[model samples]
Target: NRCEYCGDENGPFEIHHVRKLKDVSKGTEKWKQLMIQRKRKTLVLCKTCHTDLHRGTLPDNRFAA
Candidate 1:
């Protein structure tokens, strides 16, 4: 599969949650429900893109260019 961010199809890929799981508080049922609902909001990213995303340096047009 190709990376959703950079369209890289020849490297290791990882599922990246749009909303990081760790950022969601686990202290409430509502939060847990929201987390479950938000699970589908993910993107397949290549290792490089994933790293860039974490570093806040991923280009907005990474896949378009």
Candidate 2:
């Protein structure tokens, strides 16, 4: 499959989590459940797009707060 962001099908791809694990609260059960649910939400991105995403250059809607 192609990357959802840049549509690159070249090299390797990575599964980028829509919600960061660190942002989820670990103290509450509800938050924990939410964290688990969030884990299932991910986006496939190419290596370049993934790097751009982490560098805050790619304007992916999934990473928007």
lDDT of 2 by residue, 1-65 (tens): 87765567775989777465555445343323444565645667788777876775665343312
Q: Which candidate leads in lDDT? A: 1
Model 1 — TM-score against the truth?
Answer: 0.59
Looking at model 2, report the run of 10 residues with the lowest lDDT sum: 27-36
Q: Estimate candidate 1's alpha-carbon lDDT, on a 0 to 1 scale.
A: 0.62
Q: What is the lDDT of residue 35 in candidate 2?
A: 42
Superposed by TM-score, candidate 1 places the C-alpha of residue 23 at a distance from the truth, in angstroms, of 9.3
Which sections of candidate 1 miss by over 4 Å? 19-40
* C-alpha RMSD by candidate, in order: 7.8, 7.7
TM-score of each: 0.59, 0.53
Off by over 4 Å in 2: 20-40, 59-65
Residues 8-60 of candidate 1 have per-residue lDDT tens digits of 77979987774655554452433233445556456677899778867867666
